[model samples]
Target: MKFVIHDRNNAIKVIDSDKDQDSVVKGRFVQDVLYELASKNSMEFIGWCHKDLEDFINHDQLNSIFHHELIMASYSTTGDYEIPEAIGYIENSTTFLNVKPDVNYPTWLMSSDIGGMHAMVILKFENLKGSTKTSFDGFLNHISKTALSEGLFCYSSPGLLKKDSVSIESRQNKINLFYFVRHHYRSRWLPLLFLDYLLYEK
Candidate 1:
């Protein structure tokens, strides 16, 4: 399932999904989109690939708790094919935006918009609902305190909320997902770090 994230700092930067806004875009449309997003949001950009995840873990200098495996990667780009419109939400003041990822080929996927001063990490897993509540709570506890305060919301065949077990119907039938937000800048990576814990235990 995808989490549709919205950030006040980053609105949906419209891509000319149509012609006319044509630029020599190729290879990494996702990166291009991300860079554009970062530029718009005025944040530094770091585009990590599948290989980067593994490589970062092996490197000594970049010994970070954050890794690539914890992130949901998207393959489709505007460079290879037509890039479609991306819709993200902005919390009333534009501080928070829940941007759910669009579908990709073969296996469905999700994405995290890690821009602005805040970092984001989106994790995709199967059978989470069927899993135990302790499993989820463990994930919530593992992340930084700031993330815990912001809490999380689950989205799926029927959207669910962690704060309140409310199920909202979603047009997208196949994906089920939730979003955990970390409001404190210092603990931003806590949610992403907990991803490995969730995958291993559940």
Candidate 2:
């Protein structure tokens, strides 16, 4: 297996080789991330993106260091919501940056391969006492569009219908969503919906 690191410029370059299809992730995911998270004996660096998409892509990679100000800028209803962060071994280079956080627990979010402004959510039903990820992109989309129209950003959106989360989202949750927005533009997200629900559907 030939692992090749293709730059964003050659996102779709073709190499006529008999080495089976090269392991390449084009434009949808952060290549560096895949390289670190994926399984391979030796895959080439083949990805798609202009550059490191953190400063302005999803939630911002580092604020001078970890551009997570958007998540931090949001105010939470919960008085003591501790902000969480993404700890990509390949991204942060080290775990020492977390400092001494009050709640140092871990968090993870996964999304299906959806695209463009669409979002996935887990609807928890008190009656059923269960939760499920919905193809609810339309709902989240409407909320985001409405929120923007109301002079708000998704980061500050509450992420629910007739309820709310403890805080905007643990800083970690918000930041992770931001990262999601950055790379997977149309993938399902774990973040809550926008603040105001203008249109409700039965």
Candidate 3:
């Protein structure tokens, strides 16, 4: 992959053939400037409206960051209910939440990815009989309700819902959903119907 770096005046330019396609040249540079500026100014760098990191990121990068935040923020709500673990890791970093979360954890939501609004939640059904159903109907109902009521949506993968999870444990179960939200950027992966519901409700 070829990469180009240009100075503010367009007088200085550097090229790199080794830079990856997803690499962020402008973002890294902007981040450095924001950090120095914030340090000197004594304020938050990434979240600042005047110099928000959102302004510096491209769509693809923003999407990756959004996904990262969704996982992180959704992490906080995991195992919140009676379940032992609401979300479980699949690959080392990739996780599986039972249902969707109320919030999306964005990389830029807070100072660092780890410190940001990483939330996870488990929903437990009480005094329930029969196996906890996680079929299409149940999943749709839960996701729709959340989206309609809270302006949240189930993140989407290419062919299926973005939720990562497993079957319920006994009559006691946790509905796991993983999500993250950032203040500025919106992901197309979000539940569009929910967004419509929110707009209409308001």
Candidate 4:
């Protein structure tokens, strides 16, 4: 059974999840995408990673976040792919994702529009209805506290919130990525820190 939740942050973990012969080929492509994205996100956000900085989400880091549902449950549990068109939500800190599963060669060929004001991972969910409660909760938790909050009245949506048309931008070589890190972190230092520079940069 596959976890309904997915993201580029741990694309390798996802890649590692499957060990089929096909995954071998796809995994290589995913690594290339990861290399490109982790480098850009780090470089823009904190002036780290000069095309060869080794701090993209490590194996341990992936293990730490593997149980996203569990950690997020304490977080009031919540929450795509090619996603030719889906109501995507982003704030800042874009992540790379041209495709999901990245397990098939077909997906690799499909172009991606991963740019956004938020950290995004390219993913694809087949037969998503099976995990509605789990997936939706994950989705809500992902985008929660993001809409509006006068500090007193935080708003939420009962149904799925989606957009008819979505657009993607290029974050390559962009800067000030640290500026928006505060808005997304769960009021924590490590999260923002990790996103900006990962485990290294003291």
- In candidate 1, how many Å is residue 189 off? 21
Compose the digit string of candidate 1's lDDT tens values, residues 29-133.
232333344344432212222221221211221112113222222221111111111101111232122333232122112222111111232111121223333
Each model's TM-score? 0.19, 0.16, 0.18, 0.18
TM-score ranking, high to low:
1, 3, 4, 2
The stretch of ten residues in a row with the least summed lDDT in candidate 4 is 70-79
Model 4 score (lDDT): 0.23
Ranked candidates, highest lDDT first:
3, 2, 1, 4
lDDT of 4 by residue, 1-202 (tens): 1111123212222222222221222222322333343344432211011111122212232233222221111110011222111111223312224423212111111112211111122111222223323222222223322322312111111111122223223122112223233334444643545454433333
| lDDT of candidate 1 at residue 192, scale 0 to 100 | 48
Query: RMSD (Cα, Å) of candidate 2?
Result: 18.3
Q: Is 1 or 4 the stronger prediction by lDDT?
A: 1
Candidate 3 residues 7-83, lDDT tens each? Answer: 31111222222333323334333223323333443421121111112122232322343344222111221223222
How far residue 161's Cα lies from its native spot in candidate 3, in Å, is: 20
Point out the higher-scoring one by TM-score: 2 or 4.
4
Runs in model 2 deviating more than 4 A are: 1-37, 41-103, 109-196, 199-202
> TM-score of the candidate numbered 3?
0.18
